[model samples]
Target chain A: MNAEDRADHFIGRLDAAAAAVEQKLDALLAPSTLKGEIERPARLLEAIRYATLGGGKRLRPFLVIESAALFGLSGEGPLRAGCALEMVHCYSLVHDDLPAMDDDDLRRGRPTAHKAFDEATAILAGDALLTYAFDVLADPATHPDAAVRANLVLALARAAGLGGMVGGQALDLAAESAQKPLNQQEILTLQAMKTGALLRFAVDAGAILGAADQRQAATLTRYGAALGAAFQVADDILDAEGDAAALGKRAGKDAERGKATLVGLLGLEAAKARRDALVEEAIAALEETGLGDATATLAEAARFVALRNS
Target chain B: MNAEDRADHFIGRLDAAAAAVEQKLDALLAPSTLKGEIERPARLLEAIRYATLGGGKRLRPFLVIESAALFGLSGEGPLRAGCALEMVHCYSLVHDDLPAMDDDDLRRGRPTAHKAFDEATAILAGDALLTYAFDVLADPATHPDAAVRANLVLALARAAGLGGMVGGQALDLAAESAQKPLNQQEILTLQAMKTGALLRFAVDAGAILGAADQRQAATLTRYGAALGAAFQVADDILDAEGDAAALGKRAGKDAERGKATLVGLLGLEAAKARRDALVEEAIAALEETGLGDATATLAEAARFVALRNS
Candidate 1:
C-alpha cells in the first residue's frame, strides 16, 4: 500500500483501540458495590474524568497495543495495559499543571485541572488517578497472572516515579536554573527520562504482555526507545511551528520559557531530520522481529508521528 | 503469658521486620546500572528516606507480616509486602503535610517534608515514594505471580487513592463547611477510609500471599477491620490527651481545628470504652480462625494499640 493509504488504515485501527481502552477504563473505575447509599465525590471524579478525557494523541496507549501485536498477543491484557499507561500519563499532566509545578492554565484547549477546580482538589485528583492506575492493573478481573501483573506494576512505577518521570522533572527544573543554557546531550537526557521513559515503558509493557522471548522483547524495546525519542522530537517541532488552537495548548511556550527542546538545540531543520531518522530506525527495529503482518500498521504510525500536523 | 511480656516479644519481632523492609527499600532505590551515570536525585531521595525512616510504630508493616504469619507464609514475600505498605503510608504522610494539604510542620518528631525542603520537592517526593511502593511489589524477585501482584496493586491503590485516603481528606475538607457537627456514622466512615482501609489492605494483602481457605481469609479480614478501627481510636485518644513531645506531633490539634474525631463525638471515656470493645472483637475474630500460633502476636498487637501512649 502507498504511504497515505497505509497511514489512513493505521489511524483507523488506532482510533478503534483508543475507544476500546476508554470503555475499559470506565468499567475499571466504576464502584464495585452499590449496596449502600454511597455519595460519589463528584468534584474529584470530575477532575479525574476531565484530565483523562481531554484530547491528546493517545500515542502511549497506541504504542502499547502495537508492540503487543508485534508479539502476537492481541486481547484484553494488552488493552488494560494501554489504559493503565494512559491513566498515568493523564495523572502526570494534571500534576504538571499545578501551581507548584509548570503552572500552565491551559491543557488540551481547556483550563487545566487546577484552573477548572481548585489547586488542592487538582493535586488530590492527580494523586487519586495515579493510585487508581495501579488498582486497575491489580484488579482480579483484569490481570490473572500474579507474576506478570507484578512486573507491569514494577515497570510502571519505575518509569513514572523519581527514577523516571520525576527524575526528569527535577533535572528539568535544575537545568532551567536562572541563566543556565543546557547542551544538546543534557536536553536529550532530560527528555529521554521525562517523556521517553514512559513511552518506552508503554511499548516494553506490551511485549511483556505477549510474553515474548528475550531476543524478541529486546528488539521491541529498541523500537520503543527510538519511537519515544522520535515522538518527543516531533512534539518539540509542533510546539515551535503549530498553532495554539490546533495543538490544543499554548504553542511556543517551550521556547518562551527557554526550556530545552530538540528544535532549540538542533535547529528546526536538524530536529526534523533527526525525527525522520528515528522513525526509520523504529520501523527497522520492528522489522527485525519478523512479525510483518502485525507490525505493518506500527511502521506507518511511526511515519505519521513525523508527518502529522499536530 | 502476661500482656506486657507478650507485647514486648511482639515489639521486638516488629522491629526486626521493619528493619528488613528498610534494607530492601534501600536496595530497590539504589542505582540499577552504573552505565546510566545517573546520580540519585539526592534531595528527593533524602526526603523519601527521611519520611520513611522517621520511626513511628510501624503498625501497618507489622500488620502485613502478622497477617502473613496467620496463613503460615513466613518468608521474603511477606517482608516485601510489609515494605510496600510502609512505603504507601510514608508517602501519604508526606503529601498530607504539604502546604496545600494539612500544612503541618512536624511529623514523627521531625520537620514535615515540605518544611524540611521546598513545597515542590516534597510533593514530588511523595509521588515518587508512592509509585515506588508498587514497584517493590511488582519486582520479579519478590512477587513472581503477575495476577497476585496485580491484586495487591489494586488493593493498595483503592486504599490510598481518592476512593480511600484522598477521598476521606476531601470529606474532611467539605465537613468544614457543614453547620452541624458530624455524626458518629460520618466520623466512622471517614476514619474507615482514611486509616482503616490501608491497615485492612496490609492485613489482607499478607493473607493473599498464603494458601488460606476462603473461611480463614474472611476471619483474618474481620480481625483486621476491627483492629484497624481500634488503632484509629487510639490515635484519636492520643490526639486528645497525649503530650506533644511524647507523641512526636502536636497533640489536641484535631480538637483545635474542630475536626471530627471519635473522641470528639463519643467523649474521652466512651471512646476509650469503644477502643477496648474493638480490641476484644479483634481477638474474638482471631479465635474463630483456630490459627493461634501464627496469630498470637497480631492479637497482642491489637491490644497494644489500645494501651500505647503514642
Candidate 2:
C-alpha cells in the first residue's frame, strides 16, 4: 500500500483496538457487588471513569497494539497491555491537571478531572486508575502469563514512578524556581523521563508479550525511545506555536510557566529539525526488527507527530 | 507455653521476618547509577526511603509472613510479599498525612513525610511507593508462579486502591461533615475497607503462595478481617487514651478532628470490650485453619494487637 493508504489502515486498526480496550477497561473497572455486605462507593469509580474514558488520542494504547501486531502477537495479552498503558497515561493526565500540579481546568477540550470533580477526588481517581492498571494486568482471565504480566507491571511501574514520570515532575518543580533557564540537554532529559518513559514502556510491553527475541526487543526499544523523544519535541513545538482549539489544551502555557521545552532550548526551527532526525532514527531502528507493516506504520506515525499542529 | 511466653515467641519471629524484609526492601530501593544519559535523582529516592523505613509497626508485613508460614511457604516470595505490603502501608501513611487529608505532623514518632520533605515530594513519594509495591510483587526474580503473582497484585491493588483504602479515605472525608456520629456498623465497614482490606490481602497472599486449600484461605481471610477490625479498635483506644510518647504519634488527635472512632462511638469501656471480642473471634477463626503452629502464633498476635501500646 502507498504511505497514505498504509497510515489510514493503521489508524483504522488503532481505532478498533482502542474501542475494544475501552470496553475491557469499563468492565475491569466496574465495581464488584458479589458481596452485599460492602456497597461499592460510586463516587471514586465515577471520578476515575470520568478521567479515563474522556476523549483523547489513545496513542499509548495504539502503540501497544501496533507494536504487538508488528511482532505477530494479536492475542488477549497484548490488548490488555494496551489498556493498561492507556490507564497509566490517563492517571498521569488526571494528576497533572490537579490544582497542585499543572492546574489546568481544561484537557482534551473538556474539564480536567480535578476541575470536574474536587481536587481530593481527582487525586484518589488518579491513584485508583494507577492501581487499576496493575489489576488489569494481573487479572487471570486476561493476562495468562504471570511472568510476562509481571514484567509488564514492572515496566509500567518504573516508567510511571519515581525514576520516570515522577522524576520528570520533580525536575519540573525544581526548574520552576531556577535562576537560569534549563539547557537543551536538561530539557531533553526531563521530557524523556516525563513523557518518553511510558511511551517506551508501551512499545516494550508489546514486544515482551509477543515474545520477541532479545535482539528484536532491543531494536524495538530503541525505536520507541527515539519516537518518544520525537513526539515530545513535537509537543514542545505545538505548545509554543499551535492553536489552543487544535491542541485541546492551553497552548503557550508551558512558556508562561517557564517550564523547560525543546522549542525553548533550541529555536523552533532547530527543534523541528531535531524532531525530523529523531523520527528518521526511529524508522531506521525499526528496520532492524524485520516487521514491514509495523515499521511502515510507525514511521508514518513518527512523521505525523512532526507535522501535526497539535 | 503461657500466653505471655507464646506472645514473646511470636513477636520474635515477627521481628525477624520484618528485619529480613527490611533488608530486601533496602536493597530493592537502593539507587542504581545509570551511565551517561540518565541521572538517578537522589532526592526522590531519599524521600521514598524516608517514608518507607524506620516507621510504623510493620504489622502488614507481619501478617504476610505469618500467613505464609501457615502454608509452610518460606523464602523470597513471602519476603517480597511482606515488603510489598509494607510499601503499600507506608504509602498510605504518607498520603494520609498530607495537609489536604489528615493534616498530621507526626507519624510513628517522626515528622510526617510531607513535613520532612515538601508536600509535592511527599505526594510523589507515596505515589512511587504504591507503584513500587506492584513492581515488587510482579518482579520475576521473586515470584515463580505468574498466575499466583497476578492474584497477589490484584488483591493488593483492590485493597490499596479506591475499592479499599482510597474508598475508605473518601468516606472519612465525607464523614467529617456529617452532623450525626457514625454507628458501630458504619465504623466497622469503613475500617474494613480502609484498614482490613490490605490486612486481609496480606493473609490471602500468603495462602495463595502456600497453595492453601480454599477452606483454609477462607478461614485465614476471616481471621484477618476480624484481626483488622480489632487492630483499628485498638488504634481508636490508643488515640483516645494512650500517651503520645507510648503511641509514637499525637494521642486524641482523632477526637480533636471530630472524626468518629470506635472509642468515640462506643465509650472507652465498650470499645475495649469490642476489641477483646474481635480478637477472640480472630483467634477462633484461626483455630479452624488446621495449621497448628502458625495459627497459634497468629492467635497470640491477635491478642497482642489489643494489648500492645504501640
Candidate 3:
C-alpha cells in the first residue's frame, strides 16, 4: 500500500480498536457486579460511566493494542488491559478537571464530570475509576499469568501514583505559584510525569501483556517514550496555534494558566521541530524492534502523533 | 494467662504492631523513590506522610496482623500487606476530609490533610496514597507467589473500589442531600460498603496471604464482617454520645451534618446493644475458625472495637 493508504488503514484499525475498548468499558461499568462486589451504587456508577464513556480518541488503548500486536499478541487480554489503562486515563481527567485542580467545565465538547455531577461526586467517581483500573488489571481475565498481571499493576501504580503522574501534578501546581518560571529541564520532568508516564506505560504494558523479551520490551518502551513525548509537544503546539474548533477542548489555556509547556519554552517553530524529531526517534526505536513491516501501523501512529491537530 | 492478662497482652501486641506499621509507613513515605519512579515531589510527599504518619490506632493493620497470625503467617509479607491496607485507609480519610467532601479541619487532633496542605495537595496526596496501596500489594515483597500477589491486588481493589468503600462514600453523600432519611437496610448497605468493607478486607486479606482453606477463610471473613460492623456501630455510638476529646476530632459532626447513622435511626441505647451483639457474633465466628487460643487476640480485638472510648 502507498503511504496514504497505509495511514488510512491505520486510522481504520485505530477506530475499530477504540470501538472495541468502548464496548469493553461499557460492559465493565455496567451494573452487573464482578466477583466479590456487593453493590454498584447507581449515582456513583453513573458518574463513573459519564467520565469514561464521554468520548476521546481512545489513543492510549490504541497504543496498547498496537504495541501488543508487535509481539504477536491480540484478543481479549490485551483489549481489556488497554481498557484498564484507558480507565486510569479517564479518571485522571475527571480528577484534574475538579474545581480544586484545573477547574475545567468542559472536556471533549461536553460538561466535565464535576461540572455535570458536582464536586463531591466527581471526586468520588475519579477515586472509583482509579480503583477500578487496578480491579480490571488484576482480574485473571486480563492475563492468565499472575506474574504478568502483578507487574502490570505495579507498573501502573508507579506511573499513576506519586513520583509519577500525581507527583507531576503536584509539581505543575507548584509551578503555577513558583517564585520564578520553571526551567526547561523542570518542565520536561513535570511533563514526563504528568502526561508522558502514562503514555509510556500504555506500550510498556502491551509489552508486559505479550510477554516480550527484554530487548523487545526495551525497544517498544523506547518507542513509547518518544511517541509520548512527541504527543505532548504536539499538544502544546495545538494548544498554542491550532483550530479551537477542531480540538474539542479548550485551547490557549496553558498560556492562560501560565502552564509550563514546550511551546512556552521553545518557540512554536522549535517545538514543532522537536516534535518531528521525536517522531523520527520513535520510528527509529520501532525499527530497532526487529518487527519490520509488522511495525508499519505503529510507524503511522508515530507520524499521526506528530501530524494530528487534536 | 487469665482473661484480663490476655486482654492486656493483646493491647501490647496491638501497640507493637502499630509501632511496626508506623515504621513501615515512614519508610514507605520517605524521600526515596521506588523501582519505576522518576521523582517524588516534596509537597506531595509531605502531604502523603502527614496524612499517613499523623497518628491513628492503625486498627485496620492490627486486624490484618492478628488475622494472619491465626494461620501462623508472619514476617515482612504480612507487615507490608498491613501497611498497604493502612495506606488505603489513610487515603480514604484524607479524601473524606476534603472541602468538597466532608470538609473537615481536624483529624486526630491535627489539621486535616487539606487544611495542613492545600485542597489540591490533599487530593493529589490521597490519590497517590491510594495508588501506592496497589503498588505495595503487587510488589514481590508482599508475597512469594505471584498468584498470591495478584489475588491480594484483586481483593484490595474490590474492597476499596466502587462496589465497596468509594461507592459507600457516594451513598453517604447522596444521603446528606437525600429528600428522606435513609432506611435501616439502606444504612446497613451504606455502612457495610463505606466502612465495613475495608475492615472485612483486612481479615480476608490475611486469609489470602496465609493460604487458608475455604472453610477457614469463610470463618475468618464472617468474623471480620461482625467485627467491622461492630466497629462502625461503636463509632456511631461514640459520635452520638461520647468523647470529643478522646476521639481527637469532632464527635457530633454526623448529627451536625444531618448524616444518617444507626444511632440516629435506632437511638444510642439500641445501637449499644447492637454493638454488643456484633461483638458476640464476631467471637462466635472466631470460635468456629478452629484456631482455638490463636483466635483469642482476634476475639479481644472484637471486644476492643465495642469497648474502646475512641
Candidate 4:
C-alpha cells in the first residue's frame, strides 16, 4: 500500500487499540464499594478513574501492542502491559499538573487532576496510579512467567525513576531558572529522559514479553530510540505551530518559558528535517528485524509521529 | 530481665538498626557521576540525599531487620530490603509535607523537603526515591531468587498503592473537608491503611525473605498488624501530649486540624490502654512463632512501640 493509505489504515487500528485500552483501564480501575467490615474508600479510585479514563492518544500502549505483534505475541499480555505503561504516563501528567509543578489547569481538553480534585487528592491519585502500574505489571495476569514479571517491574522502575523520567523532570525544572541556557546536547539528553525513556520502555517491554533474542531486541531498541527522538521533535514542532484548542494544552509554552527545545534552537524547517530524518532512521532500523510487512505499521507510526498536529 | 530493661535492650538494637539503615541508604543513594555523554543531575540526587540521609528514628527498617532476624536471614538482603522500605517511607513523608498536603514546616527538627528545596524539586525527589526503592528491590542483589525479588516488588507496591498508604492518605484528605466526621470504625480503617500497611509489609517482607511456612508467616503477619495499631496509638498519644521540641514536628496537629485520631475518639488514658492491649496481643502472636529466645527482641520491640518518647 502507498504511504497515505498505509497511514490511514494504521490510524483506524490505532483508534481500535485506544478503545481496547480504555475498556481495559475501566475494568482495572472500577469504583470500590465498602465490602464487609473494611471500608474501601471510593474517592481515591474516583480520582484515578478520572485521570485515566476517556483521554489521550494511547500511543504508548499502541506501540507496546504493535511491537509485541511483530513477534506474534498478542492478546491480554501486551494490552495489560500497555495499560500499566499508560497508567505511568497518566500519573506523570497528573503529578506534573499539580499546583507545585506545571500548574496547568487543563489536560486532554479537560480539567487537570489537581484542578478537578483538590491538590491533596491529585497528589494521592498520582501516587496511587504509579504504585498501581507496578502492581499491574507484577501481577500473574500480566505475565505467567515470574522472570518476565520481575524484568517488567525492573524495566518500568528504571525507566520512570531518577535516572529516567523523574531525573529529566528535575533537569527541565533546573533549566528554567538556570543562569546559563542548556545547549543542544544537554537539551537532547533532557528530552530523551523526560519523554523518550518511557517510550523506549514501552517498546522494550514488548520485546521482553515476546522473548525476543538479543539481536532482535537490539534492533527494536534502536527503532524505539529513533521513534522516540522523532516523537519529541514532532512535539516540539507542534508546540511551536499548533493551536491550543487543538493541542489540549497551551502552545508556545517552550518559547514562553524560554524552555530549550529543538525547534527553538533550530528553525522550524530544520527541525522538521530532523524529524523526517529520525523517522527514516526508525523505519530503516525496522528493516533488519526481518518481520517483513509486520513492521509496515510501525513505519507508519514513525511517519505519523513526524506529521501529527497534536 | 525486667520489661523496662528488655525494652531498653531492644531500643539499643533499634538504634543500631537505624544506624545500619542510614549507612546502607548513603551507599544506595550516593551522588551520581556520569561515565558517558549522559549526565545524571546532581541537584536531584542532592534533594533525595538531603531528605533521607540523616533523619528520623528509622522505625520501619528496625521492624524489617528485627523481623528478618527471626528467620536467621540477617545478611545484606534484609538490610537492603529495609533500606528500600525506608526509602518509600521517606518519600511519603516528603510528599505528605508538601504545602498542598500537611504544609508542615518542620520534619525531624529540620526544614521540610519543600522548604529546603523548591516544591518541584521536592516532588521530583520523592518520585525518584519511590522509584529507586523498587529498583533496589528488583535487583538480584536484593535477593538471590527471582521469585523473591518479584514478590518483594509486589508486596511493597500493594502496601504503598491505592488500597494501602496512598488510599489512606486520600481518605484522610476527604475527611478534612468531609461534611460528617468519621466514626470510630472508619477512623480505624483509615489509620490501618495509612500508617499500618507499611509496618505490616516490613514484617511480611522478612517472612517472605526467610521463606517461612504458611503458619509461621501468618503468625508474623498477626504480630505486625497488632504492632502497627499500637504504633499509631502511641503516635496519637505523642501528638496530643509530647512537646514540639521532642516530637520534632508540630505537636497536637490532630487536635489543631480536627483530624480524626484514636486519641480523639477515646480519651488519652483510654488510648494508652488500647495501645497497651495491642502491644500484649503483638507479643502474644510472637509466642506462636516458637522461635523462643530468638523472638525476645521482637517482643521487646512491641513494648518499645508502646513507650517510645518520639
Name the best candidate (by TM-score): 3
Which candidate number has the best DockQ? 3
The 0-to-1 C-alpha lDDT of every candidate, in the order given, reads 0.81, 0.82, 0.90, 0.88
Winner of 1 and 4 under lDDT: 4
What TM-score does each model's chain B reach against the true chain B? 0.94, 0.96, 0.97, 0.97
Candidate 2 vs 3: which has more lDDT: 3
| B127-188 per-residue lDDT for model 1 (tens digits) | 88888888777766555666666767777887787767778777776676579888999888
Task: Compose the digit string of candidate 2's lDDT tens values, residues B1-310.
Answer: 9867888888897788778877878887877622225775667778999988765567787788888888778888888888998998888888778877778898888889889888777877888888888878887755677777777888898788776888888878778877987887888888998888888898998898888999999999999999889989998998888898988887888899899798888799999999999999998898887776657878877988877797
Clashing pairs in 4: none
Candidate 3 per-residue lDDT, tens place, B234-307, comes to 99998987787998888888999899999999998899999999999999999998888889889999999898
Worst 10 residues of 4 chain A by lDDT: A31-40
Candidate that scores best on lDDT: 3
Q: How do these models rank on lDDT, best leading?
A: 3, 4, 2, 1
Q: A71-125 in candidate 4: lDDT tens per residue?
A: 8899999999999999999989998888777789989889998888778888888
C-alpha lDDT of residue B250 in model 4: 81
Q: Which CAPRI level is candidate 1? A: medium
- Cα displacement (angstroms), candidate 1, residue B198, comes to 1.2
DockQ of each: 0.56, 0.59, 0.75, 0.64
Report the Cα RMSD per candidate.
2.3, 2.2, 1.2, 1.6
